[model samples]
Target: MSFDGEQYPGVMAPPQKAQGFRLNHTMLRVKDPEKSLAFYTGIFGMRVLRRLDFEEMGFSLYFLARLDDDEAIPEEVGERTVWTFQQRGLLELTHNWGTEDQDDFAYHDGNSEPQGFGHICFSVPDLEAAIAWFDSNEVSYVKRPEQGKMKDVAFIKDVDGYWIEIVQASKMEGAGR
Candidate 1:
């Protein structure tokens, strides 16, 4: 079950003829940039790594990261704009004024369940602290810190109606399959 990456680094490398590729970021459209920024930055503690304003389009894009390092920005050149930050991973927030209808607008109504795109997850050090922060701030969560089928995993959600899965490693002893 243990992968010794260093021992078999070649196996993990790209094919000899294939170009190198890495996961740059996942972009999600937001109805309100300010509201989305507030939830991501205020509640989740993500920092605004950079901001770009599309003057002709009348929309702004902000890249936020949980990491404090600025060097994590990708060097790849393309039309896809990006914002980089450090956390468990990087989050790219893209706002396209011309393509508002293309945004992912799926949501779980009270009677219906979530389908298609599920939710974004974050690993936290303390589930209790995260839950308390959400509760105190009046943030709604689909499920509080409850025991998952596995040992110590928990979940929560943000104001923009995104679910966050929080896993506490200390509780996951032999729970790994």
Candidate 2:
């Protein structure tokens, strides 16, 4: 079906109560914090905004974001923690204790049989440059831009095997047409 504003109920008439609501973050369970952190920070250029550890629960939560060039991060831990949750487009990685030690440990990538979650997308300014960057880092690809029917889009796998959809808005002029 073609794009239609009235296709979904309540979408055409948004609720007033949800005016102030905004997406804070998306959480993903990871097997190893070090590997996941490296992929997110080193590859994706995200900064570790805040890290919360729960020794009693045997898990940890790492909040990350790709802050603006001139954005000033809070110096103190409490301030940083507060500031992190207030921002949009943040990524939270949760790691359960001892999962890294289990050689067979793996998280559902949401792209295989019995799929549930699909993928997270990143809109890059330059799709070519981003693809080259991924190549330079030897990032595994789920689909190259030219490989699929969706010529303007691409997908790459992260350290935890999660699919990351990459796109350039300008390149997708008539993507679904």
Candidate 3:
């Protein structure tokens, strides 16, 4: 949908013209690959669509996706690498080798002083059930529903301390039956 700031009778005005570009993925650096992988693939049910290791660079890239049965995921590594870039919404996790051993290792979550980046959200069919699942898996929560002003919303923290907001799909804006 291209919008040149033209107004439609039943639609809201676009703030600016869209450039028709798609978001491929959001990258996050992880320290412990095993822990991060377990959290994303085991607990969250996301499949590792692609895994690329640069041995000389001392880092690896893992692309994950929440795919359905109808979707086509490549089997061969070369085709998978090309296919991974084609999807719009995928999570890219970069594991820098040897970083997990540093005693003072940490990454700025962008929520502290001079805050900039916020959180990534996931809409669930049942927010309560999702919260329970997270709890069952011993995942840490940044903000629970009952503790926030927005009682219907909740936030959980990933292993690297990145926030993930959880919202009820049926209750969220623009969601319908």
Candidate 4:
């Protein structure tokens, strides 16, 4: 499979070698921890798996994951840290303590002039239902499911202006790069 980073225009699966490697997480530099945390946790239903603070660097990292079962997450710090790294496809939010106070603080969203990174994708069980829920919650959608050529694919923007693709698990084919 040739993954080319274009939803519906490339292979959805990664190469065989990629199978041996797991994507632990994607880190996003957030401006406001409160807003970013609320958006992901409230809308995406991702729970905080771990939190790391660097006082010297004046920054913090929040690891989040989507839980499907009642499996209790490790409570101990060391156990949770180990378990957090074992999970695949987790989201990490990095908050620089002073960014919230900076008037011009902003991270490259990988969509404009210098696009270095692409959007993250989430596979939902029901595309229609998820879309309805997003609409009811007044979520900012860059592209709705039925609006583009790829009817089953959609894109929503996070609080920091990062794009997130939402697709139904049943329609996973042609929804990735």
Candidate 5:
């Protein structure tokens, strides 16, 4: 099951000497921390690992992750900050002060014209249950599992309008068969 660079033609292999590399987190600028935090924490079930505020810069960073049941979190703030960076697959929300008060401020979701950043994906244990939960929560959907060519996959919008792809790996295993 190991990766074979030959599978991807013309893709160069990584340097043998390179080490200790991993994707830490992806950041998205949010207009309102309250709404964004609620959507991510409440809807997605992600816990706020750490919140860093900069009074002088008029901004704050909220790091969140879906932790496993056995995962141990440090009690101290300093220790937790160190621990948060060590984990993988984290989402960071950045809120600039006063943007929420402007009444017209918003970030480009990158899914419209001239798209760049596509979407963040979440793998769930039960696709049907997840979709039902989303429906109950009144979450806006771009695509449902049954509506598109790609079956067993769905896309929903966050409060900030960022697309979040929902997938259940077990169901997707039989795709294209």
Candidate 6:
């Protein structure tokens, strides 16, 4: 008698697979949400997607997106406008009110040398061009592209002293040669 797979009663059922999740956003606690927002929006060219004020919690949250174009919309719908560039990713800025002692608060101290949790990274099309732009703007950078195992990595700091890592994906393969 031929044994069919379905006819075998002793066979156990297959295990279920878990669903995958994608990265949504990274949240950072800022000393001043307004100031942080201005740096990211003004210098980095990010747009405010949404802003929520939690008076009860004494905290405010602002969602920002990096947009390609710098066009301004009407004041009425400006806040709700969805910038095209942020569709790729987003940055979430959180501000807690009534917190006077920021010294004890956990925040990225740009004053200190680059150590653990160095900076946020962004992939760029042209590394040389980006570096040139940084030079023209008088922005200081470490210029260590791909130190150690991580190649094609460049470091720069924003106006607020937050470190930024610029990476060129294409050059990563031949990096450190």
Provide the overall lDDT of each model, using Cα atoms, as 2-decimal numbers: 0.63, 0.92, 0.84, 0.90, 0.93, 0.67
lDDT of 2 by residue, 3-98 (tens): 546465556655788787889899999999999999999998999999999999999999999888799999999999988888999999999989
Candidate 2 wrongly placed segments (more than 4 Å): 1-7, 10-12
Q: Tell me the lDDT of model 1 at 13.
A: 50
| Candidate 1 per-residue C-alpha lDDT over 20-87 given as tens digits, one digit per residue, 9 for 90 to 100 | 54565556666556677888989888876667788987777777777645545554533224334222
- Better candidate number, 1 or 6, judged by lDDT: 6
Model 6 weakest 10-residue run by lDDT = 79-88
Model 6 regions more than 4 Å off: 1-20, 68-88, 98-106, 109-116, 142-152, 175-177
Top candidate by lDDT: 5
Q: Highest TM-score among the candidates is held by which one?
A: 5
Model 3: lDDT equals 0.84
> Could you list the CA RMSD of all candidates, in the order they appear?
6.3, 3.2, 4.6, 5.0, 1.7, 9.6
Q: Is candidate 1 or candidate 5 better by TM-score?
A: 5
Clashing pairs in 4: none
Instruction: Give candidate 3's error at residue 159 in angstroms.
Output: 0.8
Q: Whose TM-score is higher: candidate 1's or candidate 4's?
A: 4
**lDDT comparison, 4 vs 6, better candidate:** 4
Candidate order (lDDT): 5, 2, 4, 3, 6, 1
- Which window of 10 residues has the lowest lDDT sum in candidate 4? 2-11
TM-score of each: 0.66, 0.92, 0.84, 0.84, 0.93, 0.61
Question: Can you write out model 4's per-residue Cα lDDT over 138-177, one digit (the tens) per residue?
Answer: 9999999889788889999999999999988778666545
What TM-score does model 1 achieve against the real structure? 0.66
RMSD of 6: 9.6
For model 6 the TM-score comes to 0.61
